[model samples]
Target: MDHIFRASRQWERIQNRYITEDAAVDLTNLKSDPRNFKLSLWDPTTNGVRYLKTLAYHLGMELSPAELARIRRTPNREIGDPTTVRCGGETLCMDYLQATYEVGFIEREIDLSGARILEIGAGYGRTCHMIMSNHDISGYCIVDLKNTLRLSKAYLRQVLDEPRFKLIDFIEVDSLQDDSLRSERFDLCINIHSMTEMSPETVRAYLDLINETCSAFYVKNPVGKYIDKSLDGYLQGQEAVEMALENGPLRQLLDIHDSQAVQAAVPAFIEGYRPGDAWDCVGDSRALPWSYLWQALYKNPRKPSDG
Candidate 1:
């Protein structure tokens, strides 16, 4: 797999930086522990079904029978359960359901038939596989730490065909500033659950890159959790949005609170049917200020002269 999914040395530096200094637990260790890793655990059937239903309600789009069938067929790449959710005799993996929800949401907003997409923190390529398999994207780039991308590349290769796989390009974090990246432009940039974990400076850097490279962007992260003191201070969700509005070359189009999903998830979380640390309602802004999905759609700002 290493032979098939190669990484540049720059990826090594980024991986090291995250492991040694980042506030979150070492991703390498997290990747190894399937039981505790949030990505590894599968949501309950009830919660899973509710998530899909809620997303559909918000987007005003329903999943086709064929689309649901495809999701049921996609096996779980992570360790927990090959069949994460069993609904009406159909089995679906956690990643499959999540990817379906995310892709379905995006499809409602934009036609990704041949869009160029840049995804920061493509965990094991769950969403990547779903999007590539279902959509006719022209190009898809995954930018993340070396080890993380390695997992994604290997997992994706198992499910994606050669032609679809060929569309993928892996970019190391250290090379984010390269002329190649700066010159390139994308239809959309996506970051989910990653920016909230990063320092504000790191988040700002990525925002800068997204502004320079993409016409639109989507981010879904927690509202408030002061993970890094030096960079973000006490800011989280809305604060982050304010900062982006002030500095980034983009404006908000939508911001939806994720309370629906969070509310649906709380029951399973309380039952210990869900995985990872229990969803703590205390000390986390995501819960206190009404847990939000925050589907912020932003487009590049027009030049002052054009306006």
Candidate 2:
């Protein structure tokens, strides 16, 4: 999968550093605080710590002090310039809180225990860290850019054992005919925030891979292709009215004339269960706070298609 973001100078700089990186690379902001270049993951600067409390309330997640302490542990502390606030006598980053919500959301439907898992485009493996720290999965595989994999591998190794997880670079997954991963199987595959940054062809390629090897899939991304200032060109973007986002930059970008904006998904992203589609929708897509992103769960229990 040729990620569209890989073409950016930001990626190239990070990629070079990964090869010549030293001890300071451990605190590289490429994963956590890339100035204004988020790549796909949100850090404390873009996603402030303020909204996490409200997100918890909306998720209706109840946590005892002990659980909160466990859940809010900041794994990215040594990775970037993490912005932390003292909450409930614990230092927590907003990204960790969001990762916690993501884990909670997934565990609500499926049992992750001993479930072989794959997370494509995992940022710095924050969500992966959250899951592995809390649940004992059979094995976890992360497929991402070499630059990202390097950083995530470093960060994850700090907390995770080498044998428990595997990191595969995107270069290893070439074309639909590639059978390099044919021997592997997973109970679940997940992509968060980054799929929308990929081209339609790349996105479709991942779906094909998921359809082949995984029993279930989860994703949190925007539904439509809207203009974004950062990337200049458009990728799969979020819709305003669809996610019920308030009047803001996203609503402006959709060029809406009414109280709501309606736009169809370009290139036909498989976001939910529709008749004739392979996936069975687990539930309705839930909107993320203050953004056009929505989360959905889908399952395909049939044999991998041979076509």
Candidate 3:
């Protein structure tokens, strides 16, 4: 499986900088320093219980008893001075919670049972694991940087069994150009918190691919100013989505604000900090600020150009 993975030039640069040959997939390594992904709160003392509770309340829902039990069983890491549960082993984390919320939102809006799904930028397969565990999907495709996909595949393989896991097809981001995959259609395509990190060309390329390969698509990204030094200079989430709507063969269906739990769980100073004009307090790192979570759905797919 490792031999099959290949990295694009864009991702190769990122891999050289952050990922190592002996990199182990674990909560500490993932949260501490990573090329493609970053964790907001890494303090050991920061407990996500209140944040999750508030998030569920604000979103007009609650975690079921089963979900709570599962969260408890997942592995956790204690980071700060007085260590607390910040990340769950395989089943619990901010990413896992957000994925669950997104799945619930989508479930209420559409019927995905037996639907063929394509997910771009599947981080560590948190969403993939959750979706497969909860839904009856016909097929699932994961598209991402080879390095990232390697970690995701390893992580998911540990959580999902042989039969259920076999439904997933791991495709490298660069492999999207293959005509066979490009021509294959999916019922839905999803991109979460990754587009903002992509260059304009890359974003447009993905939009074109999604339009060609999917009947509908969902995006969960920030709506305000964001900067990723590795890719585009400045990413205005709203502007990007609008560009896709205007240029691509898709129409906007639904748009909603991101969960407040993201802001609530972080320090108060970070909550008010704006990007460029402000500082990132959590990691004390220089990065873009996320003003709002923009979850949107677009429909009306089109065929790819023969040229």
User: Candidates' TM-scores?
Assistant: 0.55, 0.62, 0.53
Error of 1 at 187 (Å): 0.6
Better of 1 and 2 by lDDT: 2
Order of the predicted models by lDDT, top scorer first: 2, 1, 3
Candidate 3 scores a C-alpha RMSD against the true structure in Å of 19.0
Runs off by more than 4 Å, candidate 2: 1-79, 161-177, 228-276, 303-307
How does residue 81 of candidate 2 score in lDDT? 60
Using lDDT as the measure, which candidate wins?
A: 2
> Which candidate leads in TM-score?
2
- Candidate 2: deviation at residue 226, Å? 3.2
User: Cα-based RMSD of the predictions, in order?
Assistant: 19.0, 16.9, 19.0
**Clashes within 3 Å, all models in order:** 3, 0, 2
Query: Could you give candidate 2's per-residue lDDT for residues 62-173 as a string of tens digits?
Result: 5545447547453434356665555555555667766766776787677887777888888887888888777777777778777887888777777565554553323323
lDDT of each: 0.58, 0.59, 0.57
Best-to-worst ranking by TM-score: 2, 1, 3
Question: Candidate 1 vs candidate 2: which has greater TM-score?
Answer: 2
Clashing pairs in 3: 44-80, 75-89
CA shift of 62, model 1, Å:
11
